[model samples]
Target: MSIISMGTHLQLLIHPSRSPIPHRGSLLQVADHGVRGHRHVRAHIMAARKAIEGVSDELNAVASQNMDFAPARRRVRTAFLPVQQQLNHVLFKMAVPEIQMEERYEKSSRGVEIFWKSWRPGQGEPMKAALFFCHGYGDTCTFFFEGIAKIIAAAGYGVFAMDYPCFGLSEGLHGYIHSFDEMVDHVIEQYARIRGMEEVRGLPHFLLGQSMGGAVALKVNLKQPREWDGVVLVAPMCKIAEDVTPPALVLKALAIISNILPEAKLFPQKDLAELAFRIPQKRKMTAFNAISYSDQMRLRTAVELIKATHDIESQLEKVSSPLLILHGAADKVTDPQVSRFLYDKACSKDKTLKLYEESYHSILEGEPDDRILEVINDIILWLDSHSTLK
Candidate 1:
């Protein structure tokens, strides 16, 4: 379970020594949130999308409520939810914060308000520690931070995450979505800047991405090939689930549409208010927090992200950074099989892959918190095992 630490920092929940803990009868395991996390994600998050603003609330509600609806021959969960993501080892819900990114980074960089918080280790210890995160599409750093930040912070890692360029309260053009190259390039430059920071300088620096964030981590690691200890991709969208429309088609559409209607959104609005009211888990979907807040801030854009992802297949071999790919087999979004493909193909010697069954694309957001923490713990354990930072 010891993770190598050379470049940035790495954190993962590794397999335990000897026999593993059993999950039967655990409230967290079978919690209402675990099973319904995606439905809620689609409904609650799809609810606040400004992209779907003009779309009728009725359609919005239908889309939100019916996101999981499948043809009669196949159940919604059975038909659309990719099998690779659905049957994985374990995927938990990640929820940390109801906040948004803002300021300086936005004005100078992308126009989105980006705020950062740092948590230091206990006194008496050196302060050369830092972990920076980049978020995925339609998401704010606060969204994932809501669930994972505390455990990571508590583990003595000073974590940093910024709202995506066009996300959250970051001041930027509404529909902006960065290319994988652009996004990761920004990450590498910032990483160097962070490494220069006195408190974070000497310590192991870890760069991480979950979901689309994982793709960012992968592409950045691919292009820059930082000698840092490790890079991690949780449900990295290296290739994508085979289900999406072909890249040629998507790109042609983007080319035709970007010029005329760049602001045109991808996801329309929906009824989270109704869906949240339906979740049996503690009932009422987080009382309308991040999902609701996010629903409001997101645009229907990510085509750029998708396009950037398609280009990476040619570039993955350039990545030299040590990597750990964590994927949920049951992810409804990114395919876990894609993760396997990367672990096998990436040109890194110190690479690792961990797969979780029953986890969703939003592995960090399921009802049971263990799935999320465990994955993070594995990352930390791996980093700790390989680091000389003490």
Candidate 2:
């Protein structure tokens, strides 16, 4: 998440002052009513900080451990699930009362229990199109996306998102990826069902991805070129930034070790939240994402990510879906140049790229409320323009 100066919209909701937690209803009231000229918003931020701090030590301890297996990671997630849901941020607390949300667990073709979610306009609202989400590495669709999906749904689109097997509420080794291609197949399978749903059938379908998930979306489009109408990429990992990638010798060593102990949590990694979020308050809030994979990269996961990016880089010309690529020019996690490369290489004649100057990797979640809304509005406008409803 990247930082930005607090805009008027955020000033109404967050203050640097420290205070005790306010009542949950009061916090919601302030958000719903757009209340200003009070300390309630400050109280809310301080309260959230307290809540996150209360659990940080425990979560950090768990993250520091050698959680090479699914059970260990699952245990930590289960233990902190309730705490995570209660933590608040500007995005999470934003009110979108006109949208309906649903969650369920389904058995995938590979027998993994997948956790999927949907956000749609209220029953009587007009339906326009469908947007399927692909979340970034170690991130869950259930966190910051709740507010984002609701905003999109309120704009007359059906928004669908899912936790990949082994991530979030999905059943599998937590934070483990045996094969990146198989994961993409699972996403394709689940989305195929959602596309066929009665509510969204026959509507334009778009794929939206962030960071590593950007790579996943591209792979999905490559595998089923005609299935999607367009693709939206946010700071996509077409190629990992050289600053984040390990030294070539270290990468080679990790690749060799992965074959022997694929799940070992030994690969070194920097604090991504620090690098990705520009806002100090927002970066601090990342601890509230209790289920995100924050430990050392698992040996196999690292190798698979490297291989996936390489594969996508070589096949960029095959991406034929209408494309809208958005990247933060200052993003350190994923190279913005690669997004430009993708824009130049994709075969789709209808493609666009918008680069936000001074923004960081987590553009939607970390940027100021004004900037965040700008990006969301940009996306909604693009969707409206491309949809049959327009």
Candidate 3:
């Protein structure tokens, strides 16, 4: 019976006079054995302590070499671009007419740098209309929307998209949404800049939003009631579907934690790639989306998304733009029934709602090739009808 107390020296405490102590060995022998055991334990402990201290010193030296986070972020973006280009090439076929692309960086009112890109058909073709896109949560324009933009551009319309702050190659910590209002303001500011371009000045402008982007588009239209000629929402997150949101007790816990650890990625949510795409192969391709923020949901971002949806639902009547709401009937990400709710309650007289049976959230990108083309054709026809001189 020996107890080893670990400290500067290993102290072995032995009770030599316990009841029923007639054991296999004498008390002096036991004491001798305990002394040897403590010595062995002390030697191993000293060795481990030295090893840990050496590793700690090495880690500190490595960390000191790069204290600035910005350059590390840039390195990550550089690696991501090659993957983005490869995926873009596989997705956007050159068989479609020649489309000229322009990429640029601009600063938001809040001083966050945003990455933006646009596509337009070449060959001296005049732009019929401008389609500005807002990507969904954890999605970047460079990867998923590359093909969608090409399709819209080949259809004789100029396509534009902005990677929001903290998303894609944009500046700020990734997957952190400080405030939903700030996000809405940033989108409006970027699109307003695009709308002011000399080439697109008088052309009709349409806002295309997917999932979380839908909430942004709605808020933008609400902010400036008559600026947009039309708006397209794909599974707009008006309200979080009951099935996907956390339980009441859990949400209450999150609400409290958000105030203390706003940026902490403590919220647990499903990996959206599995839930958003229906096809198994297409779902697997999402693994290579290098610039996406696929980490655990951040506390502030998740709470803001919930708050934004609630706010959007309350003011659905104020959404005055000509609306085209497309939803997947089986979408578990955002409720299709909510799209029906928006169509029923929205004040827009030209609102149209199309529910694709058995489709998932990524209707334009993740659907079958035929379905993707069909969705694109529908969008083009809508834009063509609305863009005509009226």
lDDT for model 1, please: 0.48
What TM-score would every model get versus the actual structure? 0.65, 0.79, 0.78
lDDT by residue (tens digit), candidate 1, 289-345: 222122221122445544666677567777677788887676544556777888878
- How far is each candidate from the true structure, as Cα RMSD in Å? 15.1, 13.5, 17.6
- Candidate 3 stretches with Cα past 4 Å from truth are 1-74, 80-90, 242-253
> Clash number for model 3?
0
The most accurate candidate by TM-score is: 2
lDDT of candidate 3?
0.68
C-alpha positional error of residue 169 in candidate 3 after TM-score superposition, expressed in Å: 1.2
Worst 10 residues of 2 by lDDT: 10-19
TM-score: the better of candidates 1 and 2: 2
Candidate 2's TM-score reads 0.79
Which 10-residue window of candidate 1 scores lowest in summed lDDT?
Answer: 14-23
Ranking by lDDT: 2, 3, 1
